[model samples]
Target chain A: MRGHFNYLRPDCVTECLDMLDQYGNETAILAGGTDVMISLRTGVKKPRIILDISRLPETRQVEPYGETVRVGSTLTYSELIDHPVIRQEFPALCAAMGCVGSLQIRNVGTLGGNIANSSPAADSIPPMMLRDAEIIIQKKGSSRIQKLEKLIVGAYSNTLEPNELITGIILTKIKKGYRESYQRIGRRKSLSIARINAAILGRLNDSGVIEDARISVGSVAPSPMRMTNVESHLKGRKPELKTILEASRMIAQEIIDLVGVRHSTEYKQPAIAGLALKCLEDVFLDSSVN
Target chain B: MNLEIDFCLNGSEIRLSIKPWETALDVLRNQSGLTGVKEGCGIGECGACTIIIDGKAVNSCLILAAQLDGRKVETVEGLEVDGKMHFIQQAFLDKGAVQCGFCTPGMLMSAKALLDKVENPSTDKIVEAMTGNLCRCAGYVQILEAVREATCMKAPLNKDDVTNS
Candidate 1:
């Protein structure tokens, strides 16, 4: 808060994109202001100009596009939770968003802000990855799309340019055979960052055999990543209790191999396994039996 | 850099020239003279700075004054109309929900936001809405009772019983 900065509020997305082009690295896009305000007050980020794009109409739309649902970058967590398309097709994403801060925080925090902040403990990223989410990045005149996994390179880092803005996120609709669950372990029930979280989406065939499995875990590595190895192990297998327990163990082992042993490994190893098992069971075992 | 922001604060349209670094909490408390909004934590973790912005309860500490452009902001000060206490305030007083009284303003705002959306919220809905506001005095039982009481009230207490004090 020590530095003096000019604030610009653009009413439309094109005007905001023009401001970003004019200022480049000297400007920071302010969406939701949940993360940017804290960084500004703590002197962690000092930009000469702040382009407030939270109110841009083009970046606030939540609608269906062909076979996928598109969420505007400025759409808040509350909006996402209440959107009909999101509630019906992406329950895992809804569950992940519900675990974010408190009601007050959710009222102002946006999914794009959560993605751009790129916290490894971000509750939304794991489920977003499960849906094969893609980010649409916009510059002044042109825009490009990139897979969500590729957009985020590491912890608190992404490939976005200084003059670029995230317009929206595209998530493929969950089909009929797919079952999903999101589970997280936090220090407390509310307003705590996740210690370990998992998002599982599996497609079951007529005989209850796994046709496809997609699993993603957060806070276990430098970034939230899809567990392809575990997914491969679970595919074509029955989602019985024993099979899920073994697949859960594989998820834990995958984390160890990726992040290696750390001081909190003893607790996290079992916790990750248990969380993954719970998510899988919630989606596959519980739903199928009912 | 000073910027002029025009917004509706507690049913009044006001314009203020404030520094871009000033938060909504600072503007409300220092400039607007609305001390009902407290700042327990400068960060967004605590809901002591809760205010209703466009019918949503948000932490004022996390919102910059510049972001209030053309928006409607309601605080605990706006709860009463024509010198009469809002039913929620009356219920809080009757139920003895205030102990230290630090978190009451924020708690009232959160409760009002919930009631505005749902005429009769379930117990789970009430708890979820009130989770953000933390009362260190451990008066949650009475606070819950006050919200429930406010939901069932037939009429306001009196026209002159409660003032802006």
Candidate 2:
């Protein structure tokens, strides 16, 4: 942060990729700068070039491709919250984005930035993981798609190369009968970093049995992760209060097993379970289990 | 490295040579001489540096000055025309929303941004819009009242008023 860096704003994707190709390692890709600006000030990230890709036309659109929708990397949270298709189709994702920051932060913060920054407490990740998000990344000549869960490695870390630019996040549309819910435990409602958050997408068959389930939890782990065991347990279950209670406890147990006992484990164990219970009830019971 | 960034500020087209690290908050307060944009928390946590960019309220401190290039920027100064306070400002006075006044400019800009978009915002909408801006004086009740009152008055004529004036 002490040294001076060149500011580069490329209007098109080709130019952006070319710039990244040459000055990848020495450059910091700035999408919203909600996270990067702080790092720049604190000397956490000192790059030779500050690449401003917020205005690239290629990464500023939301286009539908068959059953999936491609959300541009730089599209702000406010834009996603107001989008008709996102609102109607992906209400859980919309709610997660709405819980990000206040209106001001939402107006500028982007989903791509959230994933790239890869904060464990990012609210958007849980809900996006519910839809099975895939990130489209590109450099100069070639591009590759990575699953959202695979991209983020740990807290504030990602596997993305310096030359790689996240172009868009493609998410599958939630089909009929699927009920998705995002629940978070924060210190306060506004501008509070989520202590523990969970997103559950469940579909019940005609006989009131859970046919499919997807559960992703955040803030408790190094990165937001899917509870595959809990999801598998939920499938074909009756989604009754007893089943949900057991599944919620399993979520905490799963985390305890992965992260092992920590200083906050006693508090976070029940907290994460309670959060998962709320999300599960929202998805399965469609009302408060209490 | 310094770069010339062009953007519309408070209805006027201007350009300035800004360093790469300088934020929009820095450019607005230092280069443009608009001290109204306050910086409470340099991070995005506090909304004291809130400003409207391309019709959306954003934390100016979180935005690089170069990001404002080719975008329309609005600050508290834009709310006044010919020394007459905008209706939103008038509502603040009528409702006594200002206490210590450090968070007033940010609050006013957040309110203006909301009123500009939604014709008649509900209480929840106002709360959502102003949640970013923290009034340390605990003047939120009065501020919310002022924004509510502003919604009842002329329906945000400041944009046109600024142009006409």
Candidate 3:
């Protein structure tokens, strides 16, 4: 709380990019300030210049191009949850965002901030990864786009340059036949970090056989990762109770292969299986049952 | 760095010179003489510093004072009109929802935000909205009843009337 920093609010993306270029390593870009404020207060990070991009008009929009949607970096969880397009087209993403911090946190925590922070336990990343999300990064005079999986290089780290800003996120639209579900287990329901979370999207053919599947899990590895091995195992298979149970076990095995045995693995191993089963059931079986 | 910020607090517009690091909770309690905005947790975990900023309930502790520039804020001090307490405040008193009184302001703010959006929120909705504000005194049962009671009262002429006084 006894730190000295200069705050700058830019009206447009151009102005913000200019400031980022000028300040470079000395500046910190703030979206919602939920994470940045905590880092600043705990002495985890110290930046002389605080560039406030929460109010920039350029990063506050949600637009659709062809079959993909581009979400502004400053869009808060509340805004995204209430968006009709997101709620209709991406129920799994909406559900994942809804599980973010409490209502107060959702009102102020931005999707961009969540991505930029790159916490291995971030609830939003797994859902976005399932949808094949990409982020648009901009520096002073140029810009580039990177896949979400590639952008986040490690825990609490990303490929973003010191002078670069994440302007927005682009998500591929879910196909009409696809059904998706997000499941998370935390210490408690609200206001707690996820111990493990899963996002599953699958398509079932008319004959009741799984045609395609995408799975992503978080908080079990160095970063939130796509479970391609599990996805491949489930694809071209019928989504029966036995298949789901096997897939659940595969999810546990995948996490073990990624992070090996640890203090919490004994608990997390079964918990991951249970969560994966729940997510797959919700997307493929529960709706038909109920 | 010091900067001048103009914001509306408790239905009145005011300008002040504040540091970039000063939180809105600090400015409201120390500079603006509004001590009702308590700081149970300096971090955003606790909602003790909840305030209405542009019709949304937010933790003032997480917001920078400079971010309030050109914005409107409403703290617990704004919950009275013509020396009479708002209906939400009265319900809290009648329902015995104020224990130790530290979490009252924040609880009231969160309730007001909920009632403003949903005139007759279900019990589940009420619980969901109040999840952020915590009371270690274990007064949640009565707090839940108070919010439910406030919903049955006559709707305010203007939603801001409960907080813009």
Candidate 4:
């Protein structure tokens, strides 16, 4: 707001990275700017230069890249919902995207911005984590990819460097037997940020045995976390009502250990358990299965 | 340094030198003289400042003017045709949805964008489209009814078309 910094509407990724390197912390990559504008206005983040990367062509593409699906940082939720690959391959992400405000907010909000901002309540995190998504970050000349769980270390915190710009996200495809679900608890039906959310993806064998399981919890901890212990316990076990209910309890226990029994714990711990059980129930007890 | 943004405003092309801090609402209400776009929260929460960007609706306060480099922005003023009331406007007036009128423009624009994409949208689609724009009047029931009436009208309503009804 103070300095007359050049507004670089870079048409390409290289130009944007160049600006980021030259400016470092003094520069900020402007995606949807839904969060950036709030930061800028409140002086929480006063970047000397606003790198308008929202217009970059590379950040708008969301197509299949071989076995892995790549989502551009600039692709809004509306675009994501329309993308055939996203709708088919990552239904949980699509469901989470649906819970992100209204159609208008989804039209402008970007997946890259969502992951980069690392908001604990970010609706997309749990779903993307369930997919075991990897984030692609690029600087002036170097590029690095990290699992999203590692990228988002804490609330409103991430491993991204000042000169780094998140270009795309890579989500690995699960097998045909894989079933997933995403659920959230909010105050109202619409336009509400989630209080607690859960995403569950489990691979079941022909014999109705859980081959592998991954569950991600959001808005309960400093960051969205994967339930490793519960997942391990449910491995190769038939995820029936009994197993799912017990696994749900284990998930609640793990979350309690991490987030501690805060004031909301009395409400949240039980709420998250019910959500996890429901998600597992849908996937494990699908009528489509032969 | 100066930045030039070229976009269609109220169905006309515009080119202006905008600051880095300027918002779409700032450009619409200030430079374009379409003051119908009001800034309620300045941060995208309140629907009082909603506008159509490209083909989708968004909070004008949340979008920077520099972001509208090659997009079409339609404001509430664009709702009228030849100084006549648009169908959505007539529906609002008919339903008595206009209370303080502060939220009327945004609500109308949001409704127009929704019905434009969906000729006969379901209740869910209508609710989804207008969800981002908030009306403090808590007259949401009337607003919802007005939007439904506009959607059912099917055609644009004229000024003379109002009194005959």
TM-scores, all models, native as reference: 0.96, 0.96, 0.97, 0.94
Model 2 clash tally?
0
- Tens-place lDDT digits, model 2, residues A1-290: 44578899998999999999999989998998888888888898888899999989999888988889999999999999899988887988898998988888889889999999999999999999988799999988999999999989899889899888999999999898888999898988989989998899989888888999999999988999999988898898898899999999999999999999999999999999999999888889973232
Per-residue C-alpha lDDT of model 4 across residues A1-290, encoded as one tens digit per residue: 42344566788999888777878778877788888877876778767778878778988988687778988999998888989988999999999999987766788889999998899999999989977799999999899999999999999999999999999999987667788899999998677889889999888877778888898999888899888888899998886788889999888888888868788888878888998888888777772355
Q: After superposition, how far is residue B56 of candidate 1 from its true place, in Å?
A: 0.4
- Kindly indicate the candidate among 1 and 3 with the higher DockQ: 3
**What is the clash count for each candidate, in the order shown?**
0, 0, 0, 0
Writing each residue's lDDT as its tens digit, candidate 2 over B85-156 gives 999999999999999999999999999999989888899999999999998899999999999999989554
- Per-residue error (Å), model 1, residue A72: 0.8
Give the Cα error of residue B49 in candidate 3, in Å: 0.5
Tens-digit lDDT track for model 1 on A1-290? 44678889888888888888889789877898888888888899899998888888998998798889989999999998998988999999999999988999999999999999999999999999988899999999999999999999999999999989999999999987788999999998778999999899988888888888999999888889999988998889888899999999999988997898989899989999999999999878976685
Error of 3 at B158 (Å): 8.7
Clashing pairs for predicted structure model 1, backbone only: none
The candidate with the higher DockQ, 1 or 4, is 1
Model 4 over residues B19-66: C-alpha lDDT tens digits? Answer: 877888887788888899998877777778888887788888778888
Interface RMSD of each: 1.2, 1.4, 1.1, 2.5
- Chain A TM-score (model 3): 0.98
Scored by DockQ, the top model is 2
TM-score of candidate 2 chain A against the true chain A: 0.97
lDDT for each of the candidates? 0.90, 0.91, 0.90, 0.85
lDDT (10s digit) by residue, model 1, range B1-165? 688999999999999999987889999999999999999978888798999999999999999889998999999999999999999999999999999999999999999999888867889888889888899999999999999998877223332345433
Q: Pull out the clashing pairs in model 4.
A: none
